[model samples]
Target: MLPAIVLSVTIARPWREVYEAFWRPEAFPRWASGLSDMALRPDGDSWVGEGPDGAIRVFFTGHNDLGVMDHRVIPDGGAPVHVPLRIIANGEGAEVQLTLFRQPDMDDEMFARDRRWVRKDLATLKALAERG
Candidate 1:
């Protein structure tokens, strides 16, 4: 297992609406900067996206009621990266948290880059969620 880095942002929106924004695979590219495109597989259990590295497969493992948005990303010919995301109610808005694990082989530079990327993506998500 690798060390996990937790990042969070508070969005001025209900938990349900915030969660719904992330539930749709088609909306990934809009907020997830790393994903250039996303398309659902025929099986419907997973979705494929074009990542910085190449084609990447994603499998979401969470529930709507619990506001858990955890998912696993498998890059082509690479190990799977587990991402734990959650939406928590805060007063009338919601707080979004994402846990990113640093791969065993990742160096400081790469890990820092990943952290920045996640922060940017979270900002985008916040902007979108708050727009409504």
Candidate 2:
């Protein structure tokens, strides 16, 4: 297990609203640039999307009331990368946090790139959630 990189943002929305916006896999592409064209798999338990390398599959693990949005991203033929996401109450709004784990085999350059991507995605999510 490698150290986790955490990125967070405060959104001007209720915790539940923020969680709901991110709960749906289809909304991922709208905020996460690394993913696109997401669709439910035949099994209906996972989602398939076009990733930077190729097809990517994602499996989410959490409950609606828990505000936990942990998910596993499996790139084409690659091992799963676990991503932990959470939304918490912060004053009149909410704070969203995303944790990106560093893979043992990942180099500093790749890890930095992933960190930048996560930051951008979180910003996008905040903007989207606050737009309402």
Model 1 CA lDDT for position 52 = 86
Could you give candidate 2's per-residue lDDT for residues 1-132 as a string of tens digits?
589878999999999988877777766778878765554352378888778888988887756797888888888899988888898999989999988889988899999998998898899899999996
Per-model lDDT: 0.83, 0.83
lDDT of 1 by residue, 58-132 (tens): 887645687888878888899988888888999999999999899988999999999999999999999988997
TM-score list, all predictions: 0.90, 0.90
Off by over 4 Å in 1: 38-44
Candidate 1: pairs in clash = none
- Residue 11 in candidate 1, Cα distance off native in Å: 0.4
RMSD of 2: 1.7
**lDDT, residue 109, candidate 1:** 94
